[model samples]
Target: MDGQLLTYLFVGISFALYIGIAIWSRAGSTKEFYVAGGGVGPIANGMATAADWMSAASFISMAGIISFMGYDGSVFLMGWTGGYVLLALLLAPYLRKFGKFTVPDFIGDRYYSNTARSVAVFCALIISFTYVAGQMRGVGVVFSRFLEVEIDTGVYIGMIIVLFYAVLGGMKGITYTQVAQYCVLIFAFMVPAIFISIQMTGNPIPMFGMGDTMASNPEVNLLDRLDGLNAELGFDKYTEGSKSMIDVIAITLALMVGTAGLPHVIVRFFTVKRVKDARKSAGYALLFIAILYVTAPAVAVFSRVNLIETVSETDYKEMPAWFTNWEDLGLIGWTDKNADGKIQYLGDGPAMEGDGNKPAFDGVSKGVNGERVIVNPSNSVNELYVDQDIMVMANPEIADLPNWVIALVAAGCLAAALSTAAGLLLVISSSVSHDLIKKMIKPDISEKGELIAARLAAVGAVVIAGYFGINPPGFVAAVVALAFGLAAASFFPAIVLGIFHKRMNKEGAIAGMVVGMGLMLFYMLKFKFHLFGGGTSEDWWFGVSPEGFGAVAMFFNFLVSLVISRFTPAPPLEVQEIVENIRIPSGAGEATH
Candidate 1:
C-alpha cells in the first residue's frame, strides 16, 4: 500500500481499538469514573502511567531538542526520569495509602481546611490546562502534516475522539486505552531509531550505539566525530556543557520536583488497589519510560550526522528530495544569493568570501542572458538552527525510509499527544467537580449532578486548550518549562509537606502555596513577558532565567512554611491521627473519615 494509505490504515485501526476499549470498560459509578474502582493491576497501571507521562513533547520534540542542543539536553532526560525516583520513594505509596479519590481530597482532609483544598484545586487547574494546550497543539500539527487536513479540522477530529472515550469510560477507559497507546508510541519511536542506529554505527541497541564507533570510520569515536562537526559549524561540542553550572543544576532540580508534583501522574496511583502496588508500579513506569529516554540521544546523534552530511557538501540545487518536501512545508528554504546557482552552507555569514575569496556571486550579478539574476538577495542569510520539533518527524524521510513508516510516526505523534491530553483534561475536570463543587460549594450535590458538571467542565477546558494550541505563545520546550515551574512551586511542596510532616498546619500550607505560586509567576512573567518592565536574562535577578526560577520559588515556599508552622497550631488532633494512619498500609483498606 502507498504510505498515505498505510498511515490512514494504521491510525484507523488504532482509533477503532481505543473506541472498542471505551465501550468495553465504560464507568458504571462515581468510583469507576474517579479511580477505576481501584481494581487495576500494577503492570497495567504502570503501562498507563508511562503513556500518560510521555506526552507529545517527549515523542515529537525531545529527540529534536537533544539533536540540536547537544549535551545541554541531558537535563531533560535526567530531570524527567529522576522524578519517578522521587515519586516512588517519597510520594506514591503514602498518597495511595491515604486512599483518596483526587489530590485535592488529600489536601482538604489532611490540612483540615476547605480553603487549603480550594487553593490547591485552583493551582492544579491552571497547571494542567496550560500543559494540555501544548499537547493539543501537537496533535493538530501531526494530523495536518500526515492526514493532509487543515490544522483546525485535525484538532476537531481529535477533540471528538477524546471526548467520546474520556467522557464515556472516564479514568478506567482512559487507562486501558493509554496502555495500547504506550505500545504503539514506543514501537513507532524505537523502530526508526534502531534502523538509523544500525546504519550509522552498526549497533542494534541505540543506547549503546550512541557512544559506539562510527561505521564510516571506526578509528574516530562517535562523540569525537560529533564534536568535530559542531566545531566546524560554530556550535558547541556534543559532550561538553555549555550553560552555566548553576542554571543547569537549577533547571534539572525544578523539572524533577515538578514531575513528582503533577496531579495527573499522582492520581494514577489512586487507581491501583494496594500501597505496595503503587510502589511497584512506579518502578515499572520508570522502566517503560527509560526505553525511549535512553534511545533519544542515539537518535539525536544519528540524525544530526545525517543532516550535516546531506546539506554541508552538496550544492543547493542538488539537495535531496526530503529537503524539498520539508521546504514545501515551510520548514526548509534556500535562496540563490549570488546568481551562481550554488547554495552555500558555511560558517561565516552569507555574502562573505571564503577566507580571502570574493562572494560566490560577486561577478555573476546577471545571468548569461543578461537578465537580472541576482545570486545573493538582500535577505539571503542561512540560519544554522532548525526548529527542534521537526527533527524526529523528519528523521524517517531523511533516511529514505518507506512512506508507511512516516505515516505511522504521524499516528504515533497523535497518540502521544492525545493520551496526555486526556489525562490533563481529567485533572482539570476532577479539580473543578470533585474538589471545588462537591467538597466546597455544593456539599449536598448528587453524584449524577457532579458527573454532569465534570463533563461540562471538560468541554470548557477543551475549548480553551484548543485556542492556546492554535496560537501557542512560545515553542513546545518553553511552554513545558513554564508548566514545570508552576507545578514545582505550587504543588510539590504542598503535597510533600502535607504527607511527610504532620505539623504543617492548613494556614502554613495555604500560605506557602500562594506565596510559592505567586513568586514563580512573577519571575516567569518578569523574564518571559517583560512584566514590571524588567529586561531580559542579561538583566534578570541574579541571572536566573525563567526556566530555573522555580527552584528559588520552591525554596522560599519551604522556608516560609517552616517558619509559619512554628508560630501556628498544628493541624487538629484528628487530622494528626489521620496522618499517622496514612503512614501505614494496614489500615489503608478502611476509610478514614
Candidate 2:
C-alpha cells in the first residue's frame, strides 16, 4: 500500500482501539470518573502514566529540537527526565497517601482554606491549557501533512476524538487508552530510529548506531562527519553546547520542579489503590519513559544527518515527493537564491523573514527552478526553510523508509498527542467540577451532577484548546516548556512547603502562589509574546531567558511563603500531624483521614 492508505489504516485502527477502550471503561460514578476507582495495578498505571507524561513534545518535537539546536537541546532531556525523578521520589507517594482527587483538593484540605484551592485550580487551568495547546498543535501538524487536511481542520478532528473519549470514559477510559497509546507511540518512535540506524551505520540499536562509524565510509566517524558538515554550512558543531551555563542550570531546575508540580501527572498517582502502588508505578513509568528518552538523541542525529546529506546542493527538480508534499503544507520551502537551480542549505542566518522565522509564500508563484517563492526572503545565502517540528515526522521519508513505517509513525504521533491532550483536558475538567464547583461553590453537589459538570467543562476546554492549537504561541516544545515554567513558579513552591514545613499556613501558600504565578506570566508575556513592550536578550533579568525565569519566580515564592508563614497564625494541630504522617513509609491506606 501507498503511504496515504497505510497512514489511514494505522491511524484508523488506533483511533478505533482508543474509542473502543473508552466505551468499555466508561465511568458510572464520580469515583470512577475522578480516579478510575483507585484500583489500577502498578504496571498498567505505569504505562498510562508514561503515556500521559510523554506528550507531543516527546514523540514529535524533542528529537526535532535536538536536530536543530544540537547540544543545547540536552536541557530538555535532562530537565524533563530529572523532573520525573523528582516527582517520583518526592511527590507521588505522599500525594497518593493524601488521597486527593486533584492537586487543588490537596491544597485546600492541607492548608485549611478554600482560598488556597481556588488559587491552585487557577494555576492548573493556566498550565494545562498551555500544555494542551502544544498537543493539539502536534495533532494538527500530523493530520495536515499525512491526512491531507488543513491544519485548522486537523485540530477540529483531534478535538472531537479527544472529547469523545475524555468526556465519556473520564479517567477510567483515559487510563486504559493511554496504556495502548504508550505501546503505539513507543513502537512508532523506535521502529524508524532502528531502521535509520541500521541503514546508516549497520547497527540495529539506535544508541549504538549514534556512536558507530558510517556504513558507506568506515574511516569517517558519524559525529565527526556531522560536525564537518555543520562547519561547512556555517552552523554550530553537532556535539557542542551554545547556551550559557547559568541559563541551562535555571531551565533544568525549573523543568525539574515543574514536573513535581504538574497537576495531571500528580493525579496519576491517585489512580492507584495504595501509596506503595503509586511508588511502584512511578518506578515502572521511569523505566518505560527511558526507552524513548535514551533513543531521542540518536533519532535527532540520524534525522539531521539524513536531511542535510539528501537535500543540500541538490537540484530542485530532483527532489523527492516528500519534499514537495511538506512544501505544500508550508512546512518546507525553497527560494532560488543566486538564480541557481540547486538548493543552498547553508548558513546560520534566518531562512525566511518575518516573525517566527516562517515563510510567507508569494501566492502560487514558483521560482525559475520550480521552487516556492517567499515574499520576505532573508538576505542570508541559504535558500531552504524547514520547520524544526517537521524533522521527526519527515525523517522516515527522508531516509526512504518503507511506506508502512511512515504510516505507523503518523499513528504514533497521534497517540502521543491525544494521550496527553486527554490527560490535560481531564485536569482542566476536574479542576472546574471537582475543585471549583463541588469543593468551593456547591459542597453538597451529587456525584451524578458533578460527573455531568465535569463532562461539560471538558467540552468547553476542548473548544478553547482547539483555538490555541490553530493559533499556537510557538512550536510544540517551546510552548510545553513555558507551561513547565508556569507550573514551577506557581505550584512547586506551595506544594513543597505544604508538605515539608509543618508551620506553613494558608495565607503564605496563597500569597506565594499568587505572586509566583503573576511573575512568571509577566515574564513569559514580556519576552515570549512581547506584551509588555518586549525587549531583547539584553533586557532579561539576571541574563536569564524567560524559559528559565521560573527558577527566579520560584525562589521568590519560597521566600514569601516562609516569611509570611512565620508571621501568621500556625496551622491547626491536626494539619501539622497530617503532614508528619504523610512522610511515614508504611500504613498509607489509613492516612487518608
Candidate 3:
C-alpha cells in the first residue's frame, strides 16, 4: 500500500482502539470521573502517568533539539527525568495519602481556606492550558504532514476525537487509554532508533551503539565523529557545553521543580489504591519514561549524521522525495546561493544568527537576471530553514526506512499528542467544575448535576485549547517552557510548605503564589514578548532565560512564604492535624468516594 493509505490505516486503527476503551470504561460516578475510583494498579497507573508526562514535545521535538544542541541538550534529559525523582520522593505519595481529587483540594483543606484553593486553581489552569496547546499543535503537525490536510483541519479533527473519549470516560477512560498509547509511542520511537543504531554502529542496542565505533569510519568513536562534524560546520562541539554552567544548572533545576509542581502530574497519584502504590507507580513511570529518554540521544546522533551525509553540499534539485514533501509544507526550505545549486547544511543554529529578532538571511543581492542571489562569493546560503519540531517524525523518512514504519510513526505521534491533551483537559475541567463551581459557587450541587458541569467544562476547555492549537501563541518550545515556569512558581512552594511546615498560613501561601507567579510572568513578557522593549540578557537579573526564571521565582516564593508565615498566626489546629496525618506512613486509608 501507498504511504498515505498506510498512515490512514494506522491512525484509524489507533483511533478505533481509543474510542473502544472510552466506551468500555465510561465513568459512572464522580469518583470514577475524578480518580478512576482510586483502584488502579501500579504498573497500569505508571504507564498512564508516562503517557501523561511525555507529550508531543518529548516524542517529537526533544530528539531534534538534542541533535542540534549536542552536549548542551543533555539538560532536557537530566531536568525532565530528574524531576520525577523529586515527584516520587517529595510529593506523590504524600499527596496520594491525602486522598483528594485535585491538587487544590489538598491546598484548600490543608490551609482551611477557600482562598488558597482558588489560588491553586488559577495556577493549575495557566499551567495546564499552556501545556495542552502544544499537544494539540503536535496532533496538527502530524496530521498535516501525513494526511495532506491543513493544520487547522487537523486540530479540529483532534479536538473532536478528544471530545469523544475525554468527555465520555473522564479519568477512568483516559487512564486505560493512556496505557495503550504508551505502548504505541514507545514502539514507534524505538523502531527507528534500533534501525539507525544497527545501520550506523552495527549494534542493535541504541544505548550501546551510542558508545560504539562508527560503521562508516572505524578510526574514531561515534561521538568524536559527531564533534568533528559540528566543529567543521561552525557549530558547538557534539560533547562540549555551549551554555554557561549557571544557566544550565538553573534550567535543569526549574524543569525538575516544575515537574513536581505541575498539577496534572501530581493529580495522577490520586488514582492509585494506596500510598505505597503511588510511590511504586512513580518508579514504574520513571522506568517507562527512561526508556525514551535514554534512547533519544542515540536517535539524535544518528539523524544528525544521516542528514549531514545525505544533504550537505548535494544538489538541491536531486534531493530526496521526503525533502521536497517537507519543503512543500513549509517545514523545510532552501534556496541555493553562490549559484551552486547545492544546500549549505553547515552553520551555527538560529540562536547564533540574525539580530536576535529576525531569521538569518545571508544573501539578498540581485543577480544579472534581476533574481535574488541565494548564495554569493561570501559562501552565504541562508536559504534553508528546518522546523525543529519535524526532526523526530521525519527521521524515518530521512533514513529511508520502510513506508509502513513511517505510518506507525504517524500513529504514535497522534497517540502521544492526544493522550497528553486528554489528561490536561481533565485537569482544566476539574479545576473549573470541582474547585471553582461545585466547591465555591454551588456547595449543594447534586452529584449528577456536577458531573454534567464537569463534562460541559471539558468541552469548553477543549474548544479553547483547539483554537490555540490552530493559532499557537509562539513556537512549541517557548510556550511549554512558560508552562513549567508558571507551575514551579505557583504550585511547588505552596504545596511543599503546606505539607512540611506546620506554621504556614493561608495568607502567606496565597501571597507567595501571587508574587512568584506574577514575577515570572512579568519577566517572560518583558523579555520574550518585548513587553518592555525587549530586555536583553544584560538586563536580566541574573542572566536567566525566561524558562529558567521559574527556579529563581520559586526560590523567592519559598523565602516569602517561610518568612511571612513567621509573622502570621499559625494554621488552625485542625489544619495542622491534617498536615501531620499526610506525613505519616501508617494508617493509610482509601479515599472516600
Candidate 4:
C-alpha cells in the first residue's frame, strides 16, 4: 500500500482499539473516575504515568530542541528525568498515603482551609489548560502535515477521538489507553532511530551509535565528524555547551522541580492501590520513559549529522525529496538568493566563503531574510532554518526507510498527543468537579451529580483547549515550559510543605501559592508579552530568563511559607494525627474522613 493509505490504516486501527478499550473499561462510579478505583497495579500505573508525563512536548518537540540546541538541550533531559527521582523519593508515596481524590483535596484538608484548596485549584487549572493548549496544537500540526488535513479540521478530529474515550471511560479508560499509547509511541520513535544508527555507524543501537566510528570512514568517531561539520558551518560543537553556566543550571533545576509539581503527573500516583505501589510505579515509569529519553539524544545526534551531510553539498534547486516534501507542508523552506538557482549552504565561515565575505540578504526571502537569518553574507556555509519538531517525524524519510514505517510514525505522533491530552483533561475535569464543586461549593452533592458535573466540565475544557490550539499562544516547547514553571512555582512548594512539615498552616500554603503563582505569571507575561518593552536576555532580573524564573519564584514561596508558618499557629491536634497517619502505608486502606 501507498504511504498515505497505510497512514490511514494505522491511525484508524489505533483509534478503533482505543475506543474498544474505553467501552470495555468504562468507569462505574466517581471512585473509578477519580482514582481508577485505586486498584491499578504498579506496572500499569507506571505505564500510565509515563504516558501522562510525556506529553506532546516530549514526544514531538524534545528531540527537535536537542537537535538545534545540541548540548544545551541536555538540561531538558536531566531536569525532566531527574524530577522523577524526586517524585519517587519524596512526594509520590506520601501523596498516595494521603488517600485523596485530587491534589487540591490533599492541600485543603491537610492545611485545614478551603482557601488553600481554592488556590491550588486555580493553579491546577491554569497549568493544565496552558499545557493542554500545546498538546492540542501538536495534534493539529501532526494531523495537518501527515494526514493532509487543515489544522482546524485536524484539531476537531483529535478532539472527537479524545472526547470519546476520556469522557466516556474516565481514569480507568484513560489509563489502559495510555499504556497502549506508550507502546505505539516508543516503537515509532525507536524504529527510525535504529535505522539511522545502522546506516550511519553500522550499529543497531542508537545510543551506542552516537559514539561509534562512522561507517563511511572508520578513522573518525561519528561525533568528531559531526563536530567538524558544525564548525565548518559556523555552529558550535555537538557536545559542548554554548549557554552560560548559570542559565544552564537554573533552567535544569527549574524543569526538574516543575516536573515534580505537575498536578497531572502527581495525581497519577493516587491511582495505584498502595503507597508502596506508588513508589514502585515511579521507578517503573522512569524505566519506561528512559527507553525514549536515553534514545532521544542519540536520535538528535544522528538526525543532525544526517541533515547536514544531506544538504551540505547539494545545490538549493536540487535539494532532496524530503526537503521539498516538508517544505510543501510548511515544516521546511528555502529561497533563492542573488537569483541563483543553486542553494548556498555556506555561511560566514572561513572554509565556505573567503575571509570577511559575509552573505547579505535582500530582505525578501522566505527562510533567509530574518534578523537572525541562518545564512550569512559570506555564503560559505548553508544557512537553513528547519523547524526542530520536523527532525523526528522526518527521520525515517531521511534514512530512506519504507513507506509503512513513515505512516506508522504519523499515527504514533497522534497517539502520543491524544493520550497526553486525555490525561490533562482528566485533571482539569476532576479538579473542577471533585475539588472545587463537590468539596467546596456543594459538599452535599450526590455521586451521580458529581459525575455529571465532571463530564460537563470535561466537555467545557475540551472546547476551550481546542480554541487555544487553533490559535496557539506560542511554540510547543516554550508553552510547555511555561506550564512547568507555573506548576513549580505554585504547587510543588505547597505539597512538599503540607506533607513534610507539621507546622505549615493553611495561611502559609495559601499565601505561598498566591505569591508564587502571581510572581511567575508576571515574569512570563513580562518576557512573553514584552509588557515592559522588547524583552531581552540582558533585561532579565537577576539573570533569570522566563524559562528558569520558576525556580526563583519557588524559592520565594518556600521562604515566605517558612517565615509565616513559624509565626502562625500550628494545625489542630486532629490534623497533626492525620499527618502521622498519612505517613504510614497501612493507613491508606481507610477511606478519607
Model 1, stretches more than 4 Å misplaced? Answer: 333-381, 585-587, 590-593
Off by over 4 Å in 2: 350-355, 590-593
On a 0 to 100 scale, what is the lDDT of residue 180 in model 2?
99
TM-scores of the models, in the given order? 0.92, 0.98, 0.95, 0.93
TM-score of 4: 0.93
> Over 4 Å off in model 4, which ranges?
345-383, 585-587, 590-593
The positional error of residue 402 in candidate 2, measured at the CA in angstroms, is: 0.4
Residues 1-593, candidate 4, lDDT per residue (tens digit)?
Answer: 88889988988998999999999999989888877888899998899899888888888888877877789889889988998898888888888777775778888889988888888899999999989988998898888887889889999999999998999899999999999998888888888888888889999999999999999999999989988988887777878997888778778888888998988898788787767778889999999999999999998898888888887646665565777666655455444454445554544434222111223334344543322222343343344446667788888888788988898888788888898899999999999999989988999999999999999999998998899889877657778888988988999999898887888898888888899999999998888766756476788878887878889999999988888888889889888887777776673562242
Pairs that collide, model 3: 337-374, 337-375, 338-375
> Model 3 over residues 498-561: C-alpha lDDT tens digits?
8788899998998899889989888888987779677887787788888789999999999988
User: How badly does each model clash, as a count of residue pairs?
Assistant: 6, 0, 3, 17
Query: Of models 2 and 4, which has the larger TM-score?
Result: 2
If ranked by lDDT, best first, what sequence of candidates would result?
A: 2, 3, 4, 1
Q: In candidate 3, what residue range of length 10 has the lowest lDDT sum?
A: 352-361
Sorted on TM-score, highest at the top, how do the candidates line up?
2, 3, 4, 1
Model 2, 1-593: lDDT tens digits are 77789999999999999999999999998888888988889999999999999999999999998888889899999999999999999888888887786889999999999999999999999999999989999999999999999999999999999999999999999999999999999999999999999999999999999999999999988889999999999888989987889899999898899888999999999888888899999999999999999999999999999999999999999999999998887788888888879988886564441125576786598889788887777888888888888899999999999999999999999999999999999999999999999988998998889999999999999999999989977778988989999999999988888788999999999999999999999999998888889887779988888888888999999999899989999999999999999888874662231
Cα TM-score of candidate 1: 0.92
Residue 52's lDDT within candidate 2 is 99
